[model samples]
Target chain A: MAEVVTNLSRKEQVIRMAAELFKEKGYSAASMRDLAQKLGIEAASLYSHIKSKEEILRTLCFDMAAEFRTSLSEVEKQNVSASEKLRLGIIGHVKVMAKDLTASAVFMNEHRHLSQPWLRDFLLLRINYINRFKTIIEQGVSTGDFKKDIDTKLAVMTLFSSLNWMPGWFNPDSTIEPEKLGQQLADMLINGLKQNA
Target chain B: MAEVVTNLSRKEQVIRMAAELFKEKGYSAASMRDLAQKLGIEAASLYSHIKSKEEILRTLCFDMAAEFRTSLSEVEKQNVSASEKLRLGIIGHVKVMAKDLTASAVFMNEHRHLSQPWLRDFLLLRINYINRFKTIIEQGVSTGDFKKDIDTKLAVMTLFSSLNWMPGWFNPDSTIEPEKLGQQLADMLINGLKQNA
Candidate 1:
C-alpha cells in the first residue's frame, strides 16, 4: 500500500488519504480533523494543502472525469474497428479505476455532496464524459457494427453502468484482474450490441 | 401525482413524501421538517406517522428488498427455460423500481446511512437476492444454455449494475417503457452470455 502512495507529493498524499476517509466514513460524516488525524498531522496543517473536504471531493470527481476522457480519447484515436475500440475503451476505463481505487470510489459515490458552482461544473464534466462514450456507440451503430435499431443512449448507459458500478463491488484483493474483468465484460456487451450473432 | 397517493393510508403517504424529499435533498441533508414542509404538516405530526427519517428509509429499503424477493420468487416458480426465467426476472425487477421511483432511488443510494442491525439485515437480504439471480444464471450454464465459461458472478454484477443504476437516470416520461428497457437489456446480456454468440 505504501508503494501505491510512493513518489506522490504531500498535497497528493492528503487528497488520497481524504478519499479513503470519505469512502469509509462518507463525505458528510468525514471531518477535516479525521482526515488530518489519519495523516498524522494537525487539522490546521491539513487546510494548508486542501481548503476543505468538499475540495477533495471536487478534485476526485474532476480527476476521475479527466481520467475517463484520457482513456476514451486514446481509444478514439485508434484506427481499429469500432468493436475493437469499445473493447479497448472498456479496458482503459477499468485500468483507471484500478489505479486509484479509493479516489475513484469516492468520486463515484460522494460527488453528490458537492455544492453550487462546483457541483454544476463537475456534473457538466460528467455529461461530457458520458457523451464521449455515446459517441463511440453512435459511430458503431452508423457503421453497422452494432444493431441497426440500437438505442445509443440506452446502450451507452448500460455499458457504463456495468463499468461504473465497479467501484461499489470491485474487490481490490480479488484474484480476477481489472483488465481481464474488463475484457470479459466488453466481450459480453459487444456480443449483445453486435448486429448479428 | 395526487392520484398516486390517494389510495394510501396516512402513514403510507408520509413514507412516500419522505422518499421524494430524500431523493431530492438526499437522506442526510433532508430533515423531518422538510418532509413535513413538503407535505404541509407540522414536524411533530410527521413523527406521529413515522418515528424518524431513518425509519422511513428503513421502511423503503426493506419494502424494496421484499419487492425484489417477490419478483425473483415469482420468476423462480415459472416452469420455463432458464433463459425465460432470467428475462422475466429482469422485467419484474424493472417494474418494481419503476413502480416507486423515488423510494427505489432512496433505497439504492441512502441505505448506506442505515444503522447497524438494520443495515446488516438489509445487506443480508440483498446478498440473498443477488445470489438468487446468480442461481438462475448457474442453472442456465448447467442446462447448457449459456456460455460454460461464463463468470457467473461477473455476469450477475454486470446485469444488476445496468438495472440498479437506473434510478439515477430513468425518466418517467420517456417514450421507451420500463418493461421494454428490461427486455432489450436482457436480450443484450443474453447475447453476451450465450454459448455460441
Candidate 2:
C-alpha cells in the first residue's frame, strides 16, 4: 500500500514536470522520453503512472482550470459587493498564479493543445469561469454599482486578461507584498486609473 | 529572370508557411519536410530561401519582436503627456496584435524556445518595451498625474498584463472599435474599475 501511494505521488510529479515542459516547449515538441529522463526514470517506467503524453497535458490543464474555478467559488462565498467580488477574484487569481506559476502558464497558453474531446471539456470549464466574472459585472451594472455604459464583455475580457497573465511576470521576491499586490489590482479594477475628485 | 522571381516568392512563401507551422506544431515537431509538404514543394527546394529550421525561427521571432518594438516606439514619438503616451502605446499594441495575431502569438509565447543569442536579443527588446511603460508610470507620478503612493511596479505590471494578453481575446469585429478599446483600456489603467463619484 505504501508503494502504491509513493507510485501515485511519483505519477503526480511526472505530470507536473511534463506540464512545465509542455508549457515551455509546447505539446507537439514535448515527448515521453524527455519527461522520463527529467524524472530520472526509464521512458517505459512512466507508463505505470500515466498512460500517455496527452494524459499528462489533460491532467495539467484540467487541474489548473479546476483550481481557478474553486478559487473563484471560494471568493464568491465572502460577503462582498459585486465590485468587491471582482476585486477578490483578481486577488485570488494572482495569488493562485504566484503560488503555481507553471500550472497557470499551462492553463493560459496551452489549453488548445489537448485533443478534441478534452479540448472541448477544458474550454467548457474555462468559459464557465469567464461567465462568472461576466455575471458579476452584469449584477454590478444592474444594481447601479458599476457604470451602465460599461461593456461587460470587454470589461470582463480586459479584467481577466490582466489577471490571467500575472504569472508571466509576477515574482514573489519583488518589493511588492502579495496583499498589497491584490489591493492595487483591486484599486485598478474598482476605480479608474485617473485620479478621483 | 521571371522564373527566378517566381522562385524567390516561392521561397518567401515557404518561410511564412514554416512560421505558421512552427507556431502551430512547435519547433521540434514541425519538421522541414512537414514545412515543405505544406508549401507543396520539395524539402530540398526550401534551402534556397532559408538555411535551416532554426534560421526560420530566428527570422520569425525577430520580426515579431521588431513589430512590437516599432509599435511602442511610434507611441513614444508622439508629443504627449506620459499618461497619453501610455494610452497611445497600448492602442498601438492592440492594433499590432490585431493585425498580426500569428506573429504576436509566436513572439509572446515561443521566445523561450529560442537559442541563447537570439533569446537574449529578444528579451532585451521585451525589457525595453516594458521599461517604456514603466517610465511613463514614473513620469505620471513625478508630474502629479498619478498618485505618488501608487506602486509603479504593480501599476505597470497590471497595465502591461492587461495589454500583453489583448491579442489572446481581442476580436476586431466584436462591436468595440480600436480607438474605443484603447480609451476603455486606458480608463481601466489610469482610473481602474472603480465607480466614479
RMSD for each model, in Å, please? 3.7, 3.0
lDDT of each residue in A1-197, candidate 2, tens digit only: 99989988888899889877876677777777888888899999999888877888788888878778899999889888887888888778777777778888877877777789898988889889999989988988887788777778877887877787776777757877666787788776677622232
Most accurate candidate by lDDT: 1
Q: After superposition, how far is residue A34 of candidate 2 from its true place, in Å?
A: 2.7
Question: Best-fitting candidate, measured by TM-score?
Answer: 1
Candidate 2 chain B minimal-lDDT segment of 10 residues: B188-197
Model 1 per-residue lDDT tens digits across residues B85-130: 9999998999999998888889888888899999999999999999
Judging by DockQ against the true structure, name the best candidate: 1
DockQ of 1: 0.62
Runs off by more than 4 Å, candidate 1: A1-8, A40-45, B1-8
TM-score of chain A for each candidate? 0.89, 0.90
Give fnat, all candidates: 0.58, 0.81
RMSD of 1: 3.7
Query: Over 4 Å off in model 2, which ranges?
Result: A173-177, A193-197, B1-8, B27-29, B172-176, B193-197
Per-residue alpha-carbon lDDT of model 1 for A16-81, expressed as tens digits?
888888887778778888988999989999877777767788888888888888888888889988
